[model samples]
Target: MLQVKHLLADKGNRIYSVAPDEPVLAAIRTMADHTIGALLVMRGEELVGIVSERDYARKVILKGRSSSDTPVQDIMTSPVISVNPADTVDTCMRLCTDSRVRHLPVVENGKVVGVVSIGDLVKAVISEQGAEIEHLQRYIAG
Candidate 1:
């Protein structure tokens, strides 16, 4: 079972975050600069919520609100669904699918370690399947 740790090891664990009181426009700019879909909403080392492009499109743009005037807290998704490093890729996939969320913060011991996306889980699963297929082919040829 490929774990989140293995995925993080390959992709590099970097947690990008924004403050709750930060302007939504600035947060969106940071997300664009980083090429990330979401930002962890942090409050002094504590994970408060999450803000994503979906939030901006649905909450801000659709509502015709000014992004520069709105705070991240106003549009952030709270009670974030998180996973652990030890969790298997399959588990992560199920969580994301069931929750209808694209990103999940990896939390262990009440500390945020990294974040994983549905894409990451899918990639890991595909790689694992490819490796297994290669092994089976080698065994059959032997």
Candidate 2:
């Protein structure tokens, strides 16, 4: 079984984050600039929550909260569910589907190591399948 560690090994380790007191608009701008859907909300060096586009649409826009005035802590999802590098692709898929979240922070030893998206899991699975297909073809040719 392919584990998240394998995928992270290829993707590299970078935990993109924003401070909890930061304005929601700032998070939005970061997301836009980085082309990411979510930002991990941090309290200093520690993770506090997660903020996503959904939070902006539902909490800020729908609720009439000003993105420029509202802090990320006001709109973030707290106690965010995270994954570990040891988690398999199947586990990550289940977490994503069950939690209804696209992005997951990879934590190990109480420190954030990387982040994974549903797209990343899908890509890893596809690569695994391709390798298996190549192996089967080679066996047939032999």
Candidate 3:
């Protein structure tokens, strides 16, 4: 069973965040600069919410709101669905499916450690399956 800690270890625990009061445009720019789909909205060391490209599209563009004037808190998804370091990859996948979210922040000891996307979980699953198949093939060869 692959855990989130293992994934974070491979990916590195680097977190990019935006302040809640920052303009949505700034947040979008940050995402663009990082080439990431989402950013964690933080208030100091506390994780408050998450803002993504989808949020910008639906909440800002579709709503005809000005991104420069609109704050990230206005568009960010709050009451975030987060995962623990010990959580299994399957658990994160299920949470993403059930919550209809693409990203999950990894929290341990009340601290945000890293973020994982659906793509990450899928990749991990594929790698795990490949390793399993290789092991089975080796067993059969012996």
lDDT of each: 0.96, 0.92, 0.97
What are the clashing pairs of model 1? Answer: none
Model 3: ten consecutive residues of lowest lDDT? 7-16
TM-score of each: 0.97, 0.94, 0.97
Residue range 34-136, candidate 2, lDDT tens digits: 9999999988768789999999999999998899999999999999999999999999999999999999998898888889999999998899999999999
- For residue 97, model 3's alpha carbon misses the true position, in angstroms, by 0.6
Number of the top-ranking candidate, with lDDT as the measure: 3
By lDDT rank, best first, the candidates go: 3, 1, 2
The residue-level lDDT of candidate 1 at 82 comes to 95
Candidate 1 lDDT tens digits, 32-125: 9999999999998899999999999999999999999999999999999999999999999999989999999999899999999999998998
Q: Per model, state how many residue pairs clash.
A: 0, 0, 0
Two-way lDDT contest, 1 vs 3, winner: 3
RMSD of each: 0.7, 1.2, 0.8
Model 1: lDDT equals 0.96
